[model samples]
Target: MPDLAYYASLPRTRGAAAALLLDDLGRVLLVKPTYKQGWFLPGGVIEAGESPLTACVRECQEELGLTPRLTGLVCVDWAPPRDGVDAVNVFVFGGSITAAEIAAVRLPPEELSDHVMAAPEKVPELAPAHIARRMGPSLRGLAEGRALYLEDGRETPFG
Candidate 1:
């Protein structure tokens, strides 16, 4: 087995930034990628040397054509490794958009096929299992005013 030191020295996992965006009606916004079957939150892979926060903001603008000002980080999920891919570090941030902002949103044709504003209670059902697990807890963390750590989308220690 590899030593702790060896593990510590391993390559850092790739990461992505996700935004939990809410509207005046308190509905959460989720996006459907043109390339995928399921809906997802506003997010994308973090580019080299870019901060997670910056990535979230950039992705929102790219995906939804809105300049989101994220309030704070709500969750940091260390997604389980899969299919030769290293574990993904997912960062979820809290944000909101005004009615005008919502009206101004222009979905990027190449990235998204559709976008929905689901009621808070319906978000879990709209997303996949992994996304649901993290989003549920992350929204709670946003409501309670704290950050939540997660592993495979489940709440983790040092939260």
Candidate 2:
């Protein structure tokens, strides 16, 4: 195994996000962020002293306004820091929601402006570099109910 500590030393702390996978007739749910205008899964950082699982669930509810059935954690991505920022560890949880319930979800104005559903093959056009890399693999593992290990130091899986 690679030296996880080498990468861990680059960032002082970890930030978490939930990659909410809403399976819609073989399609997945994604959001186009207002600030960045790129495709991304629904999730946000874990608050101070908050559990990753709790934060994942809360973020989905707050951002999308839908209570999804969180199946399991599909992937863990480490994004090394650029400039003086901290590295990010995004915990993508596999989940499911209904198409009818999709319309009921609401996006926070500061975080996002709109949402869309796309086949996995079309994900590259919408996702940020970090996220785009893992979208397909993560979705596959999530669908299969297996955890995908993304412990690569050279690759970034979330932006």
**Residue-wise C-alpha lDDT for candidate 1, range 1-159, written one tens digit per residue:** 769998879888799999998887888889989886677899999999999999999999898888897789998999887758778999999978787877788998888988888887786777777888787788888888788998998876677
What is every candidate's alpha-carbon RMSD to the true fold?
4.1, 6.0
The C-alpha TM-scores of every prediction are 0.88, 0.82
- Flag clash pairs in model 2: 39-126, 130-157, 130-158
Q: What is the lDDT of candidate 2?
A: 0.76
lDDT of model 1 at residue 11? 86
Which segments of model 1 are wrong by more than 4 Å? 1-9
Q: Summing lDDT over every window of 10 consecutive residues in candidate 1, give the lowest-scoring window.
A: 120-129
Runs in model 2 lying further than 4 Å from the true structure? 1-11, 152-159
Name the best candidate (by TM-score). Answer: 1
Q: Assess the local accuracy of residue 20 in candidate 1 as a C-alpha lDDT between 0 and 100.
A: 93
lDDT by residue (tens digit), candidate 2, 1-159? 989989868835677867556666767789877777588888878888888888888888888887678889887777667548578777888888787778787888888898888888888777766677878668767878876667422223441
lDDT at position 84, candidate 1: 82
